[model samples]
Target: MSKNRFFACIRSSFFSRLLMGVVAAAITGTACAAGEAWPKEINLGYQKYGPLIILKSTGELEKRLKEHGVTVNWAEFQFGPPMLEALNAGSLDFAVTGETPPVAAQAAKGSPLVYVASEPASPQGEGIVVKADSELKTIADLKGKKVAVAKGSNAHFFLIQALAKAGLTLDDISVAYLAPADARAALERGDVAAWSIWDYFYAAAEIQLGVRALANGEGIVNNYAFYTSRRDFVEQYPALIDVVLDEVRKTDQWVKNNPVEASEKLAAHVSIDAKILEKALRRSNYGPEPLKPEVTAAQQKIADTLLAIKLLPYQINVQDAVWQPKGK
Candidate 1:
């Protein structure tokens, strides 16, 4: 009722309001730091390759990712280059692609797309494959012969190398630029005497269509899949990438040890039959190694090959694009 009492009461109320505001601000700041309610969902791109297909179909990757509160969202692409494109466009957090697409994408996107891991080349290898009954036995055999291979694909590199090894050139071969599906049909119908392909399809033709492997690009060079993530992703979530790499390690070993059963696991995902995959499984080297200098050198060679062949706009600085493996 007194003037001093009224002023003192008003001051106390003001102080209490100010203190509440500060506490609310601190809580809001804390909320922002902790990120949104749900953990991020990792979008992974793949191209129906056996190991990747198996990784997805068997639910191993999803199970592994769930532990981190990261849900696995799988996106399938037609080829490695497209997968890498999706990754560069920010639609994908991680994806699998061959050695060349990342190089070309990194050059085009200017974003540092680092190779987190790689599935070693198939021991039997990818190449300019042809029907068994067909007469195309070598790259020299491809001269004036129509060859079906995916353009800008690692198969493209295989054809180039196959041509070079046999003393012909890309100009010598009549390249039938087709997607993997059409390419398979072209080879089956004898529309194109040869088809350059990898893994399942390559094996499918061998079993069903009686195709023969004309050349081996394993020890030579060809499209080997890479599990790649953005450099920014690694910086922000280093441990997440490590978990991915660790999962990759576990799966790669499983894929190698159990061949027949693993092929059966991949049957549903790929176009090729399980029998074909079983045959092709023998060729694949699924053991993962971190991107090493020799590996980069091999990839750089493919990039250079593309540049020299005029498929790419220009050569990319691959060393900078590559992310150092955490193990080292």
Candidate 2:
């Protein structure tokens, strides 16, 4: 062959190999980026009622996670406090609860909890109730009277706000720290003058026992539901966090759009009457939202209130525990 042609051929071959090398590296980089480190399984905590229950019942989240080879393990709790306790104990990777539990959890020493997302405030969903014929007509009437409430739960915050509006504090009232069943029984037996609680417990009381609410959270407190996870879990598996929140958002929309069907599904799991479940569902606000600045401020107010009342040991910045994805 001619010398010029031999050299030309070598140059062409070298350029072709370089182009292939660049394309191969780009493909490998894309694959690595796509194949993020996802856990094989995740443990989720849920209460008997709420969007989480809806999500669990429909099995939509399970089906989606299954596609990623991630199995879901669900753990149930009666209320927010215990569910959050499990999260703090490392038994749950993710969970959702009402406003107060996250505040209490964040205040606890060595808690690994972080606020990942929140649902809209459903102020009318919880309240303080008295017997239909009871003399307690106003919040002011509760002074020195025994009131049943779940300690460290959302109802606890509601009771505080209620009492404060009446110029009373926790010290002025006799607080019987009891679970929902015991509280209901206490209210029925006249052992406590009133019971402060959230629905479907509130709905059940109204339906089955003819109890009357002195005041719902309408003007007293913003009863927000929050989704939480361990700080490490959020940091390590941010993508999983997005997946879970997306499912929760979808489920919330479904519940809002079809309340009757959602209530029936929830009633089946909770063993409560579908009618009562529907009542509670109607009062609740659906849709999961991120921790916006305004939300953080509202949460900060709860923390400050708890601190002022000595319910919390020390002051905490609610924003400190908020999770932020890579770019806003």
lDDT of each prediction vs. the true structure?
0.74, 0.91
RMSD of each: 4.1, 5.8
- Candidate 1's residue-wise lDDT over 1-328, tens digit each? 9999999999999999999999998987665443323347878787776566677787877777676688888888877777777788788888876666777787774665877777776536576677777766666777888888877777777778878878888788688889889999877787988888876667766777776777867556745778788876765566666666677777778878987787777776665577877777777777667777877888888778788878888777677777764445
- TM-score computed on alpha carbons, candidate 2: 0.89
Instruction: Please report, as a residue range, the 10-residue window in candidate 1 with the lowest summed lDDT.
Output: 30-39
Q: Per-residue lDDT for 61-122 in model 2, tens only?
A: 88988888899999989888998989999999999888999999998899999999888889
Pick the TM-score winner.
2
Residue 150's lDDT in candidate 1:
78
Measured with C-alpha atoms, the lDDT of residue 280 in candidate 2 is 92
Pairs in clash, predicted candidate 1: none
- Global CA lDDT computed for model 1: 0.74
